[model samples]
Target: MGNLKLFIGVLVAIFIIIFLLLIFLVYKNSNMKKNISFLYTKNIELFKANNELTKDKADLNRQLNGNDDVFSELRLALELDSVVNSLNESGDGRKIGMDKKLEGKFVKSIPNGVPLNFKGITDNYGIRIHPISKVEKFHQGIDLRASVGTPLYATANGVVEYSGMTSSGYGYLVIISHNFGFETRYAHMQNKQVVRAGEFIKKGDLIGYSGNTGYSTGPHLHYEVRFLSRTLDPINFMKFNNIFYDERKVPWQALVKAIDDF
Candidate 1:
């Protein structure tokens, strides 16, 4: 009876050991499965990150290529180019200083030399009291005082539109139409030579001679510039034409100061 009881106790110990071993094996397998799942998720994320980086690099390469169309690379680039071109086309006041007009623009030119008085300016343009009449009135042009027989010059290249003694105040009026809406007139001339109706005259060419033929206080040349039959300030045009002066003639210190201040 004692031996049978001892054998039963040994059998119970073996069963307990077997149960513990099975539980340990099951827990180890569960941990391995969880680790595999985590690794799969990380691999997917890395693949996505690599794909995005490759796309970004390709875009950079396209932009760097010189052969690529300027409009390509990005939609925003096309918009920026359009805006810059528009600003340059507007011209505004800068175009006058730069002398760079927009494409297809027909730019006119300023006339050369002083008009009217041969030695100096006797009268200016705009409204002023008439020296002879002594009444407040608008002066249409400038008066240059000079002696008779002084050679008159064509202000610009143009064809003679009219040349004759005027019924009004002009003694010997010569009109040269430069087309492009620009016309120049020389009045109070002593003689009309080298110019006639329908004759083309070059710039600086002899057109007439100054005289006191017209109603005037003294001998003078009346020069007028008209655009489409409307008078303009001849002084302004002369100043604009003065842009091509010699910088060497200007004081170097003044030029340097202007640049520095600007």
Candidate 2:
């Protein structure tokens, strides 16, 4: 009887040990799974953050390269006080303010280079003797003397408002409407069969050939700058430090030489 009792006690002890071992293994496996799950979640978050930072860096690079949109530049120039202060120091402070105000009155106005190549004034704005009429009259535009068939380009981006011959004076006329109450007219074109009405044109796009068309007496371009039908002196706008010829200038040999220097 004593031996049987001792054997039973040993068997119970072994069973208890085995059960405790099984319980410990189950707890350890659960904790390992929880740690692995936490590591995976953390890794995913880190990857997402890295991608966002890379995208932000790319955007900053584009802005530095001046590839930002025009509106963005204007907004930045307006919001940043440093830009305003610099323009003021450069003597263009008043002009910048005026430009902003005029933007509302007139259509969109952007710098479109120079009206003519740098050259001596042949016939300046104001009163001048008409080449064809041979009578002294108010010259609304300036004339640049160029060889026949010289390439003519638009001063700015605009839509063709009118493209036809005028019996009053202009021949082979091409009028571009730069929205904001501004329009430009090119007359005495040699041939403008390439451009049509209602076509979209960009600044510096070739529009026609220089010629002595309409009532013109010589191979030159009659360029006019008008504000809501009122003609303004084109020279006032061309008096910039850096100037280049557009469709409005006569493209004289002397003008071409001067432009090369510019």
What TM-score does candidate 1 reach?
0.50
lDDT of 1 by residue, 108-165 (tens): 2335455433787788988899877799998888888899888888776789998988
lDDT of 2 by residue, 233-256 (tens): 676545522222222232223332
Q: What CA RMSD would you report for each candidate?
A: 22.9, 19.1
Error of 1 at 113 (Å): 3.2
Q: What is the lDDT of residue 102 in candidate 1?
A: 19
Query: Model 2: which ten-residue window has the lowest total lDDT?
Result: 240-249
The whole-model lDDT of each prediction reads: 0.66, 0.66
**Count of backbone collisions in candidate 1:** 4
Which residue pairs show backbone clashes in model 1? 116-144, 116-221, 117-144, 117-145
